[model samples]
Target: MSGASIRAPYDNPMDRHLATTSASPTLVTGAAGFIGFHVVRKLLQRGAAVVGVDNLNAYYDPALKEARLALLRGADGFSFHQIDLSQRDATARLFAETRPETVIHLAAQAGVRYSLTHPESYVDSNLVGFGNVLEGCRHNGTQHLVYASSSSVYGANTHMPFSVHHNVDHPVSLYAATKKANELMAHCYSHLYGLATTGLRFFTVYGPWGRPDMALFKFTRAILAGEPIDVYNNGNMRRDFTYVDDVAEGVVRTAALTASANPAWGGDAPDPATSAAPYRLYNIGNTEPVDLMTMIGVLERALGREAQKRYLPIQPGDVPATWADVDALVQDTGYRPATPLEDGIAAFVAWYRDYYRA
Candidate 1:
């Protein structure tokens, strides 16, 4: 899709709902991370008191995470906690003390490639940490729990524009498996404890203050430094590269509109996205899928430099393509991720040059 096509203004119908709920404190895990930082800022902008939680692990770079936190620290309605959610006691204490009515669980050991080398980290953070979060929300009077799920959950499924209703039984990577597990874990809580939970499967989110391991960040760094960038799958990939701001908007909107049990959901042929319980799943992404080469071309234009690309075989935990079917998200919240890839990349490049003095 062209950049001009997606630069349209967003019209969110959930503005009134968000304004009404903005006074309450919301617990946001991984608040120092890419998506987390953006989400917290959006909440704060809407006059919401945000309790930010992050361990500040060395998954990529602690300096970057800390930098993100510094900006958030200056905000009026923002508070930070440097605690590892994987620690059961620490997590429990956090929930008890904060007593947050709403929770946005975005903390996880992110990165598909990293998960391959350190499977234990994924188990600890994604699985155990998520369990503790579920327990905390279950015990505390958390009215709504909106957590980050990933497009990786649609593993080994060759479906175009992946839908939430698809049965994702086969996850190709451990990271994908853990994400899928989170959805199931959430469903159990929603069914048994009557907790309202909504899972958002985000697709290739990129922008300013993004993760270093992500394509946009790495590519920008390598290109500016005159280094070679490893282009996996021989650049034969298409990603639904949703902008961070768009994703943050969707998350806040979704959180305001709490999940509810689908009355039409029956046992005979159940829908995976919605349940008989107060659980729901939605794909939060740009509906447009851009080619990897096309994305590189855009990045080159933004950076004013050409990347030295080294083509390579598809990685073990990698997918050739990913496209999100965001119809459900629009239908529910009246919000769509319409940020153009060109604009998003340009914004990221500008931030990169400013931050790195490149």
Candidate 2:
């Protein structure tokens, strides 16, 4: 492999050498987001320079995004750019200017139900934005690209403990479809450009600074305000709710260990999780699935209040259960999300109360 061309801030050979010798600075897209924010925090704490980019879209709350950015700004070795990934020209310029060595592409239009009504948003952000990220990595000297995928890709598959090797051709919603499309797009880049890419199929991620639309946050807010919380699937729905920090740790570890072609890969009996190219996929989750009612109970315990529950039928584009099989993640990265639900809830509740003054 040829040496990457160094841009400004690293134009000097000595400076470039020093920067490259240690862990290379990572460009984290969606840096103001939930998982992205945590990933950036972890990367900065590890003494790695982080170039974070976020559009700060008002999909949920821009204020929350700014709050996450504020904390990151205070940290050392952290820089931020408020750029929209969906803009091809701007994204291209960002890559040319930064010439990042590694990229964590976590920006996306993220909600399964929301996708039903807002398909165009998914098309713009997940499809077009992801295309820009891939182009940036390919044109620049990005060594590894770690992007977020979702367990929703296992749509209509009733299998327990969803595995990465299983086929994900069926996606129930545009959100899931876009995530699956990301994996395909990354593979194309890897096969064509030798871009080492890893797609993480995250389960129901919950904790501090999570998206307001997510169950945990909604439940917490409603319960605290003495409002009735919507219990979907008659509270029978289950989720493998992985903690934010654990997900961040796994992402860091995976990023450090760049994807590589599987020597054992054979086209005759191809493994969906790995390829002859430097492309791979893994399921990042807590492995333990908890029912919706159980999660509410945990939240109630954490908040010291009982939730007025309004049980409802399962909604469209929603799955009844989601469980992840993380053996492959464990075998490869030597890591698995192990945060106890109770502990995770407690931490999130603490942060929410403090952040919202509730």
Candidate 3:
């Protein structure tokens, strides 16, 4: 690590950052995934010296992920590390080499539906791997740590918009349970080590170079191939579909601002979301839950082809709807997602077509 503050790029807002030593680099754990690639791109645009680590696993299409990595590999202040965080020594060695002051840990086994078939994967990546990250941060003297949680953690809740303050104990899937476990584990780290930690709960994130496993990407493929797309719960589902760039923006802003201890927090009647230690959790979402049918309509319009729909009941480990309550996020960070659903979907479809020549 170098010992000077690298000037942020010209496009950054005046108050977006503070002067800091350059010896501590910024590290992103899942730099090749949809949200991770976007997050890495944003950090690079701001002239932040960054390190991106990923195994480039064949979770979806390794070729697509390789394309994302290709984009980052050419940047001036960016570097890539091919490693899995579940391998304790390998993960620890990378952290030691980077000496990062701020870390964005987004590498994890994703997808609620897939968790049913691959529960062990979640245990390895989301649990043990996260433990490795916490241990690394603890020994490295990291100033602040930002990581991804998910709205899937809002399982078994009928609440209109999920709030950070809400108790998220009733997880309906192994995936949600693992995310909830992350918040809990992070809370413990904050309490024991006084580490500044923030957990961001993202809604349905979609965009170009997006995961082929997500609904939007899958539907696009199905519709383009002249096949019937699965319309779960007979098209009754709703999602707060957030754009990938918007999510990346929120995450960057959060990681730069060090979390602070809540002055009013108490133990007798504890709030699971915040702590007297320098720890906080927030929802970064579109704040607009669009119906599945409406989203399909937008995709159809973008593709210029009506979807052949096969309506079916909701799959196990899947929820009917998801909305995010980001009031606290706005009050703290002064930024919220403003992109409309139509614009995001259209952009994704355009990028998908160009990337795959569909």
For candidate 2, what is the TM-score? Answer: 0.94
User: Can you write out model 1's per-residue Cα lDDT over 239-349, one digit (the tens) per residue?
Assistant: 999999999999999998999999999989999999999999999989999999999999999888899999999999999999999989999988899999999998998
Query: Number of clashing pairs, model 1?
Result: 0
Tens-place lDDT per residue, model 3, 1-358, is: 2212323454445224522445567999999988898988777667677899999998788998889888778677788999999999998899888888899999999999889999999999999999999999999888889999999999999978889989899999999999999999998999899989999999999988888899999999999999999999999999999998889888988887789898999998888678899999999999999999999999999999999999899999999999999998888878899799889888998898899899
Clashing pairs in 2: none
How high is the lDDT of residue 71 in model 3?
76
TM-score versus the correct structure, for each prediction: 0.95, 0.94, 0.96
**Any idea how many clashes model 2 has?**
0
Residue 358's lDDT within candidate 1 is 88
lDDT of each: 0.90, 0.88, 0.88
- What are the root-mean-square deviations of the candidates from the true structure over C-alphas? 4.7, 6.0, 3.0
Among these predicted structures, which one has the highest TM-score? Answer: 3
Cα deviation of 82, candidate 2, in Å = 0.6
| Residue range with the least summed lDDT across 10 consecutive positions in model 3 | 1-10
lDDT at 69, model 2: 86
TM-score of 1: 0.95
